[model samples]
Target: MILGEFWRGLKSGIVELLSALIAAGLLFALGDSAILATITLSSFSSELKSESVLEVFLIDEITQDGIDSAKTYISSLSGVSNMTVKDPEAAMDEMSAILGSDMTDVLGFNPLPFSLEVRFEPGSCDADYLNRISSGIALRDEVMEVQYASEWLDNLEKLTRTTYIITGILLALVIISSLFIFVSLHRHISTRRRDIVRNLRLLGIPPQSLIVISMMRAIFVGIIAGAAGVGITILLWKLCCNYVVTIPFLTTGFTVLAIAAPVLLALISLLISAGRSQSNLFASGS
Candidate 1:
């Protein structure tokens, strides 16, 4: 008898089931995209940080000993990842390579000074920190200047921050909209089964039992919809994986969440709908 009722309910609500599936699928896709975007941004940020290098030039009057001492001191500083000292001759050679000719041959002298290329670890490439480091380095009598592309770093930071803010906003909106759709559809189903529910109540079937049946039907719908949605999302992700780079650690976790979120949301909405319907039924009886 229970099986018969379950089948009947499933057939009656097939349209609602399909609607919920499509809506949940879309929400899951958007959520997955947002997560991937965040991971991509972090990867890009790390790449930028790795490429960041600060050039510290030494005063021409400084000796080799001064340069060696300065290199040792800077290498020991906190937040300094790596440091390489380029002698005046090496600097001139690099410049000559770029210009396709030796400047010393044309001008009779190499004007370039010895410099240290300093690279910082990820998350330490900020303006204030760089400024502080530069100030400390300038205090040394052998140091001439500390230069980096601070503007470019600042701009990248701003852009990544904006992308995160926008992604968060869109994700929130999609969740709210999905929940609304689920609740609205559940309420519609409840109204359609109102007469049958009233007859069941009159037959001495407990309201709790009736609500359980409704919840069971909702669960069946949720499971089918969740599976379908997750399958579609995984398919799309696999298709795009070759074209895009994503973090391996986060991919599995996010995929699991995407699969579970829709079913959980559907069950919760159904619970709310059933409870509300039971309350109304008792109120009308009283």
Candidate 2:
């Protein structure tokens, strides 16, 4: 009988229901997109960090013994994943590829210095860490200079931090706005059905039943809104993959959570709203 009243109430408030649904759906869609974008960017940043390498150039007069000693020392450094010694010839070839011409032929000699290309393990390198390692490497007797993209690393870190902050703010805004919409819709429905609720109360229908009815209706609206949100999110993801850089789709777990979160939020909102409304009803009835 309570559920019957819930459906009756739903059919009576079609306009209010549609308004809340659209509002919540758009908010959820935006939140999901932010989450997915953040995940993709973080993954991409990690891959780049893994590939980041420190270049240690050797002094011109360094002997083979010095090279071997340097290699052993660098290999023993903490977080050193791999190191490759690039001879002057190899360095020259790399420069040639970059310049699209043979630097050795132009200069009549390979002025490129021998260098050690060193990569660190994933999650082990950051701007400050690279700076410290490079500084320590430069202090070696046979080392000419140590170079790494410290600026780029700093920028990447900032970008990642900013992405998380923005995502957090977006989610907070969505939740707050969703709560407002839910409460407003609940009040509107209660006002419209006040007489019916009074009659039910006279017939011995407990106030708690009214709360349950409101919560159930909210959950039903939430499921529909969640579906609409996911649909919009999929469409946006496809557009991004087609025009922007490709990103991995949300996994099954994330997709399910994305759809379920709004429902949970809606249920909670109705609980709070219904609790307050029931309190008012009791006060008025007495």
Candidate 3:
């Protein structure tokens, strides 16, 4: 198929596959970007459970003065974004609302622990660092059990990792499916090889002309497939991830680049395939 064939299919294949190609393109963008988002989460230790302010288990205790001092120390640490110590009274009130009982009555003499909350900067939440801090505090006899929401952070990390893995598998499926579609279309035209040869022989046309025609068709197909895929990918990402991806640094531009880059590469691949098939036409003519 040449450029003329691409035009021929403008009404036929292009029109038919336009929607599907775009849809596939959108899926390709989402799945690929989803994995990136998840991987980014993993790369940043900010998502740690210790970062979570709420938890169900017993909390470690610290004096107001000691907690304040700890806060200052943690703040100075690299990767520490922010930190706070929620007083026992505040903790009790929050628990009271959730537990549906007067924390005063429920605890009687039991006092809510004066727990410290530390918000780490983007990179501070390493296991070694957290453990070092926890162990250092636990050694102080004045301090109760040192507690922060590490469990929730762990779960978040796992969830992010899982999302990336699933996205990767799905994207592989899309690539395979797209290649199958492209190659299948190539095969359909190739099946009419005898007729193409007979026609060329009768016209006394150069075999190179036929090759040019097929290659020209491939380029048109690539452009159509690429453009449709890119358009659909952007449209879908705008609709779906407008809010979920809240990072200020991230942009729709990356999403568009992600979609367009791959599609263009695929188009180039189609061009190469077309070139390869051209040799066959020349050989048969000889």
Candidate 4:
């Protein structure tokens, strides 16, 4: 019966199937970890960028109306996310809290000028954009100075770029390794079933049926491998959850990909193997 032959084929290739499963599972885990780390770094980068603030100090001669106008102008700027006015008194209070002593007691008068704290949108935190915005704000008559930590922003930008490059390289390597594993496993399966396949072909069995059987076997192996990979990844993620930050949607998406990747790879491998085996068998017969 066909069922008996299918069982025999499954039993014969059990070792190859197990090897493929183990190799694919480990590779998938490595790939998932790299992706998760990249996402976490990106999240941290965005958070730090959101905290960046530009301080615009007002001239001593500027009236309250002038201060209000400056605030309104800065708030209306294209990239500005937020703008808060801190009067001289508030500035003094903040300095006092930092020093743990009343600044007024030592200075007799607040020397700090009224300033606007401006925060920009994430993509707008680059050095060039910040410089342009700061220069524009400085040109205003009421503005005495515009200051921000440009050096810090530059360094953060560099770090983000490096993370992206490294993540891309890692993903590429994982994909290549996965393809190699699938191809090698498919070849081994083809060799093991060579005699049986040749016999079936001579008996007038349709080539399509043989290809489908091989594909089914591959699909079965892939499902088992994908399940193992996903389980391992979930376990490792839980164990390291305290140290790593992850987005819920990203994690869910990666998990789905992990399960889907092996099956997809298997399908590709079976198609390749089927073509090669059919050709070799027909050539020998002729």
lDDT of all predictions, in order shown? 0.75, 0.84, 0.56, 0.78
Q: Lowest-scoring 10 consecutive residues by lDDT in candidate 3?
A: 50-59
Where does candidate 1 stray beyond 4 Å? Answer: 1-8, 122-132, 135-141, 201-250, 271-275
lDDT of 4: 0.78
TM per candidate comes to 0.80, 0.85, 0.59, 0.84
Whole-model lDDT, candidate 2?
A: 0.84
Q: Best candidate per TM-score, number?
A: 2
lDDT string for model 1 (124-158, tens) is: 66665776788899888899998887788778777
Please give the clash total of every predicted structure, in order: 0, 0, 12, 0
When 3 and 4 are scored with TM-score, the better candidate is 4
- The alpha-carbon lDDT assigned to residue 14 of candidate 3 equals 48
- What clash count does candidate 2 reach? 0
lDDT of 1 at 222: 60
Better of 1 and 3 by lDDT: 1
Best to worst by lDDT, what's the order? 2, 4, 1, 3
Candidate 2: Cα lDDT at 184: 82
Q: Each model's RMSD to truth, in Å?
A: 3.5, 2.9, 6.3, 3.1
Q: Write the per-residue lDDT of candidate 2 for residues 114-188, one digit (tens) a residue.
A: 899999988777777788878988999999999888899889988998999999999999889888887888778
Stretches of candidate 3 above 4 Å error?
1-51, 54-69, 86-114, 122-142, 190-223, 226-255, 258-262, 280-286
Candidate 4 residues 19-76, lDDT tens each? 8778888877777777777777777777777777899999988898999899888987
